[model samples]
Target chain A: MSEERIWTAALVVIGDEILSGRTQDRNVAQIALWLNLQGIRLAEVRVVADRTEAIVEAVNALRARNDYLFTTGGIGPTHDDITVDAIAEALGVPVIVHPHARAVLTEYYATRGGLTEARLRMARVPDGAALIENKLSGAPGIRHGNIFIMAGVPHIAAMMLDALSGTLEGGKPLASRTMGCWVAESEVADMLGAAERAFEGVQIGSYPFFRDGRTGANFVIRSTDQTLIDACFAQLAAQLAAAGHDVVDGGI
Target chain B: MSEERIWTAALVVIGDEILSGRTQDRNVAQIALWLNLQGIRLAEVRVVADRTEAIVEAVNALRARNDYLFTTGGIGPTHDDITVDAIAEALGVPVIVHPHARAVLTEYYATRGGLTEARLRMARVPDGAALIENKLSGAPGIRHGNIFIMAGVPHIAAMMLDALSGTLEGGKPLASRTMGCWVAESEVADMLGAAERAFEGVQIGSYPFFRDGRTGANFVIRSTDQTLIDACFAQLAAQLAAAGHDVVDGGI
Candidate 1:
């Protein structure tokens, strides 16, 4: 609820494989992380199957509720991939092959000899929607209205995100400072309480993790201001040292 | 969509930790996996913050959409745990401490001699809701209007899920058969296509995994019919073996 920072987004992960628990979807977590750093809160995330009705419902709901809606999956060259038609249906638009998108797909397939009908399936998009650049595969993801449709594959999604980075209008960049020590989360309960009371704008989270057979907790202080973040981290370090816990600087 | 399937469930994960990308929620995946096997399709999965408004919105939406709703998180003895009150708001009911829930909490605290005013916060429940037994700790989860509210902790949620397992009205029990081989996903694409054609009521998914630095793929055939699933797996194995890929015995 900060001024000049009213951006909110939603993620719609479309795939029957994910709902069936056969495939673990990774794009939601990655996209949520990326958006949060830009102070763009991801308000909702829905994972639905490849069914047309389910996809249309999710797309329309998210597009109406969020400032930006991003969808991953169902953009591949398979018969089950029906995101284009579903998205078009949601927007009440016609599904047609965009010339630019077709060009990109043709160029991509031309390298291997020629484009087949199956390969051209990736070129279809909702009419009037602009193409999102895909540096990895060249067959671009399409963006219409508030919805940004990207590939289901993680590597391809990452590449699409990078290509479309500059087009996105970001909010105030959120910052965080991490301080870890050889202490449990419960041990730092009092100091955490104090830190929470001291910082109203920041969200302080304690993560107790066991890694390499060692138990430790990371007290992460997140805020928009770098100075405020640094000040909180210093106080957290001092509190940990006072509590007889080994304090160490945890990198971002 | 099958006939004679009377009930469905949805999961609403209430916590800022998940949205902040600080904690990876395991409950959604666990619930989906268990529910799928029991033939109860998880229609939607939502992750919201500890905020009462967000929780209420999601709880109401999911409750209206699915036959049953399950909520995890915000039941602990902390200020951020506000799921009880939020559920009441969603149902337009007043939240009060139930007699049985209070008795369990009082007895639990009496044993440890650590009962504080803040610790009793877990006893708050919406009116007309029944308590779901929590075997891990005496503090019980609440169920109201087909919404099952449980702890966010993975083990506690699992235990609560088990206790509520008997109460679930199921559909056709979903079965899966996995065939693991050395063939890459692309190499077995044709076999998968054929398997899908051969199995009408089943959903075949391809999972490419890497274990011990060896790349492999797992083709999982899922269906309500056990006979069709077995037959499909047999056909899949035979096709893989015929194509020079070693087929292993992998039953459901």
Candidate 2:
């Protein structure tokens, strides 16, 4: 086994909105992309409802297994926003209004309106938590131990991710290259498998798309080493071209 | 507790593309919506990797708790298509090539390409499983016990869902009404909470959006009873209107 370690993070999407299909979630992709740049792997993601028990269970399970755990949504100023309370329960801690978070909310809401009691709910966090800068909004994110609570909104989550970039301890960042071809993946599955086997440590993912009455797939080669990815991608592209399939460089 | 039972389903999204941030997932929302129409609540969704162990863990954990479990991805004819194998292991059953599935694939591939060994991989399913119709492509979905193994592609999954529509046993379908307003959700948090509290067995979700440099929100009232949703919607609309926030009947 390789001695090199890979840091992994799991995300808990705390919302009834996403579960009910009323809203399409964008946070998963955003967090996944950002985690990759920081040399962290997004290993798992759970979309759980706003229920307290559900949140507590998911948070506890994911945080115990992953190096880091993140939760998006249920941190807003609403009655359904019970992420902090649930997380606190999961961690066996009490919920408290962080002094810094309170001050930030007070200042942000000063010009708009004095922080009402309902709005003040945003200041709550798990006990002994630090604040992650919410460059997009006044309500800062909470980071308790290995768990980071972020906003449900994609842009706000982006800001929180930006604030913590490069701060976490991680191994080599994963690198990937996409090679698309206008042919059915099943037709070339054997060659693709062979290439992947030959390029030890590289993983190739085939994503098929049906567009304009044409069926095609994009094969993604990923590895922690860029050189390995490049070599694998080149071999796959050449194989597809040799098979008389038109190869498209970045995906179709 | 309400006497009416809420049939629940858990989805295990088996894919490396999604976890790698290479593909944006459309399965969760699509399955959630379809399940709602079938009167089954999509209680939770786990996006797991393509690894056999990960798939086995998630499938077993979720299947034991939920009324039905659905999985998407890794049913293709590639080396990474390990969902069927993992699921079979989780069920403690041997994998076998289903006769019906093999016959279907044999006919479908007759015109396209002779059922090559690579293509024959799609016919393999867990023992004692039935096939779900896949209208889009040659391969069919697999079903064993209460678990439904579906295609990762959104449209193909949709076709399988269509074939199984109105076939599952469920109670009343969940109904919802979206009321939008051009005001920060924080501004009306108290009233929204009050409205939700006023209605029994109804839940309200507040979604805030920042669009075109303006802040706004949508309050969604959901319940199994259409009448309950309507009444809650009306009460909330009146409250928001009285508070001087222009309420859009449908979400902005």
Candidate 3:
């Protein structure tokens, strides 16, 4: 498993609404879950303000290291949507109006008010970019090199993701299994660490919770190999049961 | 307003669960809201893995640029909880078991299970660090220099934030007003851009939504000055109304 290549990606979430605490971001988790299914690990995520300098810096830094880089938000028709221009600056490319995007928008909005100049702004993309289908909206996502530009809206972003499912080259999907116990994770910290160290190419995460006036925790075992995960989970569960802790199968 | 000093903070969310899509992060929004009340701006946020190298890199880079840095998660008693060691490494300090923290944990677990070695792990902190009280949990948060190390649990982190309220030096709190309208943001993009440019010290962010089978958007006007925010929001709302759009005062 150590010899196997691990594909990784980074995400850049661009919005001031998030920084202002006015909106809770859902893109990071959605993209992460989607990437997990694709067998590409989400390496890191940066939530940056809607500033060109900030966007450019994050994009350049992450794109250099990861196999794929995704940016959500600031791709709309509003003036705050400066993702294309900033990405173009990052890549040292010029911004151009993509003809296919323009045609799509023209047809979609032909009946619903027609594609005005402001609406046509969605047609802009970095030079040498291809389109990612967005079934919900006329404005398509952009793909330039390994970078993907997605919508700020969750449903629209989901539509674009649906259009992109299983299209990218990825390695074996990460396998995981969870076991829950109504015991303080602190009480079992040493055991968890020992189990993790005992299993090569496997990691265990302990998440403690206080619910219904009781302390409990969920132990998640992760590895590329499902057999390893199953074996580790069984050992952990058996240890918890032996320790007189009430164990739950999935989570609390 | 431009002459007034502005305080900024960056948040580093350290968790493999978050990066793996196993958990939805609530700390970013909660801390963002709390910092807003403290008159400090959440300038940037980075979600990194539980790796010490990843945490250290994010901590060093963000803490240098911003007035304060906050890291949530990875503060538990499990072996995966390496935030203290990572930050200590970042600051070139050694980890020490704080006597005060040890006392707290001893009292807390006196009846439950006694402060065993594993439970005493909560007493570990970077040297020369002060403890931030976590009323919900005995494991106090750590505050070293301008960096605040908070708990992975949302409620514990909230308690720590509550303990530190009004303690940090900050500028005037940012003020914002939102107006919603049932119209495509694209239809009013030009007016929004023009309004923002004319507002001088204010910034307007247009967030579009598709709710209740209708297209709508909320325009948020933010500035440190309440008067500026009000003036900008009113002007934009009036402009939107005059353009034949139905406007809602506090967003739809």
Candidate 4:
């Protein structure tokens, strides 16, 4: 095996509703978790307002920088939904009614006798874009270049992205381990320093928290090597116990 | 009045823990909400990893792009906590101990038997940087150029940012209105369409949902103009009832 599978992605969360705190963005965390599980690292995530210039700038930047670019929001049947137009403009393409998307929306509403020009806004797509089939609602999302534009709603976005995940390239799993000990960070600073020096391949982190009115710290060690991770955890645990502290191993 | 009073900021969340879903970043949303109340717009947000290069890159890009850049993560009494060094590298400055920071940390720990080399990691600062006083903990955050580097923990970051908010500049608040009704989005397309055309300054959005298996949609109108928002909401209400649907003046 070549071990040549390092896929990186960037997520651009659009909409002023998120910035204003009227609506919270759940897609970034959700997609990031899913992608991490699939061995793909989410390199960067940008949450911009629904402004067209901002969207166009962000879309171009992320698309140019990462292997895959995922965007959420501004794809609904309302005036503020301008992501499609902004993306099309960024790619220097024409905004048009995608036939299949139009067909899906039209058929969906036609059966219910509610298809209107307002509802048709959901069918608009940039020219030369493919539709990402939305299993939640018949209305599909647009895909132009490396950009995968999806809905803002968590349930719908997850379903649509799930229907499309198999097609995405993934990366090697980024592994980690964390050990929490009932010792102040200062008491274990030398141990953490020595561990960092010895295990150059691993990343060691200390997070101190004041929980239950008592201060404690979690020493997290991250590395791609399973052996290094295990060895380092053992060394760290022994050191903590030697320092007269209670320690617990968290294997990930 | 000069519109120059409008201040904008960008948040750069630096941690692989967040991307891996090992930690949920409540800092960004919390900051956004707080900033919004102060009439400051958090224009953009980026979540990067613990890598020095990534942190440096994000620091430079965000600082150059926004009025202020607030970063959380990679600053602690641990080896992998390299944000200070990375930020110094980004600003092309040497990471050295600032006299004031050292004094603050030393005084902070004076009651608890004082400082050590391990705790000294929290005292290092880039040349020409000011210290962001940490009220919750002894360790202080650094402010250089346009970037304010703070801790990753939600509570600490919130407290530090709140303490610093009075000194920061703010912007005109982006206003909003919520109009909920018992009509499916498809039925009110024409109303939504008319609202969009009538209020070019405002952003009209339709969020459809299902409550107890009954369908409903909330049409939210957002703008800087209060008159336009009220007018648009009035029109939207009348149109919904005219289309044979019950209307509610506010949100759920």
Give all candidates' CA lDDT scores. 0.77, 0.91, 0.93, 0.81
Error of 4 at A133 (Å): 2.8
User: Which candidate gets the maximum DockQ versus the true structure?
Assistant: 3
Question: Which residue pairs in model 3 clash with each other?
Answer: none
Docking class for candidate 2: high
Name the weakest run of 10 consecutive residues (lDDT summed) in model 3 chain B. Answer: B1-10
| lDDT (Cα, tens digit) per residue for candidate 1, span A108-223 | 76755466666677789998899888876567898997889988878778888777765677677667778877754544565776787897777676655555655566677778
Q: Tens digits of per-residue lDDT for model 3 on A1-252? A: 453889999999999999989999999999999998998999999999999999999999999999999999999889899999999999999999999999999998998899999999999999999999987768999999999999989889999989989998778888888888889999999999999998998999999999988999999999999999888888888888899986787787
Better of 1 and 3 by DockQ: 3
lDDT of 2 by residue, A49-138 (tens): 999999999999999999999999999998888999999999999998888888998999899878998888999998999999996778
Best by TM-score: 3
Q: Which candidate, 2 or 3, would have the higher lDDT against the true structure?
A: 3
Query: What is the full ranking by DockQ, best candidate first?
Result: 3, 2, 4, 1
**lDDT tens digits by residue: candidate 4, A96-174:** 9888888898788776666677678888888888999886567788888778889888888988878777677675666
Model 1 scores what on Cα lDDT? 0.77
| Model 3 per-residue lDDT tens digits across residues B128-198 | 99999987879999999999999988888999999999999888899888898999989999999999999
- In the predicted model 4, the residue pairs found to clash are B6-B171
Candidate 2 chain A — worst ten consecutive residues by lDDT sum? A1-10
